[model samples]
Target: MNLSRPLLLASNSPRRKELLAGLGLEFKIRVKEVNEDFPEHLKRAEVAEYLASHKADAYQHDLQNEILLTADTIVCLGERILNKPANYEEAFEMLSALSGTSHEVITGVCVLIKEQKAVFHDITKVFFKKLTKTEIDYYIRNFQPFDKAGAYGIQEWIGMIGIERIEGSYFNVVGLPVQKLYTQLKALGLIS
Candidate 1:
């Protein structure tokens, strides 16, 4: 596809990088350190979008002709937000909470082209079958899900066995809503 400007991906996530690359879109990785903190009032999906926009804001001055992309994903179970696990115990707790229950996986995407910017989000409902302590422990020990939200990756072994069903884009649960992002990019004339 022909693009009007260079594409810049402002993230260090390997999942996001792989997803963008799967779209056959050429982009350069340009990450900037940004605090992921959000307002205490923000809830569920709002938190993801706010953080994504915040990440984009860090490169506001650096955007010349490049279209910058930033994204954030969060796992929500009821009113609580399950962020990346800080340790093995946290991972276990997060997974245990999600076991045999339906939860929302929200991913917010930000596309910025100079002064013009578009921020949107996609939510996927994921249902997991009851997970035993042994299953959770084995998965954690083998996969070491310290870098993933909700203490798991939908593309991993836990997802394959534990996930009972899902409603909405699976890619969103993985990280980047590639289809929505592609459509948005094309609509913005960033890619053809």
Candidate 2:
């Protein structure tokens, strides 16, 4: 089909852009806002997957015979879903709790083409080093991690200094799981 149609990224995340760019595929972004909420019955992975698929739904009419990608990443520590922090205090609290702990980073993704849609997710286990109060405070004040889930960025200062190790895809901690995404996109004939 000759790349049939240009790939459309239904997100504004810079991390997603970076991840997609690694594929060496051409794509364009059209920011469309979607609610990050889900039903109370939805569990951890379900919430992420549902939100990602919902993002793709925004471009249903705009989509032709092309691939539209959408994704949502969430951090879960125990039963608590630590979403993006609202303020510095909350951000500090989130990071403090994450210190010296392992948390799950789940990303739900959707690859939509016309009527056919593939929805899936990748999980990464990130372990942080025990961060001192001063270290956490420094990160919060310097990075202002309002754009990141769990109030921290894996590629930022906190990640470089605080993240001790990870058990899964590093890119997944950053945002998108490029390896899984590559396999899925190739299987769906979304990329060369």
Candidate 3:
């Protein structure tokens, strides 16, 4: 793929990097520390969008000829938003609540240049069959999903046995909605 500008990915997630690479675009990973905080009143998609845009904003002043890409993913179970777990207990609690239920995974993406900016979000509905405590414990202990939102990865073992179905893009649940992101980039004339 040929890009009109240098693509800079502002994230540390290997999943995001791998997903983007799947599109065959050459890019550079440039991660910076940004607080992932959002206003309490912001809803599911809004929260993800805000965080993605927030991360992009951190590079505003430093950007010269680079096109910055930032993304944030969140898992929402009704009104509650399940972020990355801090420890094993939180992971167990999150997976326990998700058992035999449906949840929305929203991933917000931001594409920014010195002159132009675009922010958007994609949502995927994931359904999980009933999961046992042993299953959750085993996943937590072995997979150590402390860095993943909702304490799980759709491509991991738990998803293999636990996910009943999904209503949207599987990649969205994994981390990035590559299709939507590709469309956005193409529309922006960033890639061809």
lDDT of 3: 0.95
lDDT of 2 by residue, 1-192 (tens): 235568888888898898888877778987786777788899999998999998888889987767888989999998788999999999989998999999999999998999699999999999999999999999988889998899999999988998888999999888888889888877876554
Give the per-residue lDDT of model 3 (tens digit) for 56-150. 99999999999999999999999899999999999999999999999999999999999899999999999999999999999999999999999
TM-score of each: 0.98, 0.96, 0.99
Q: Judged by lDDT against the true structure, how good is candidate 2?
A: 0.88
- Order the numbered candidates by TM-score, best leading: 3, 1, 2
Q: Measure candidate 2: CA RMSD.
A: 1.6
- lDDT of each model, Cα atoms only? 0.94, 0.88, 0.95
**Which portions of model 2 miss their true places by more than 4 Å?**
1-4
Better lDDT candidate (1, 2): 1
The CA-based lDDT of model 1 is what?
A: 0.94
Clash pairs, model 3 backbone: none
Ten-residue stretch with the least lDDT total in model 1: 183-192
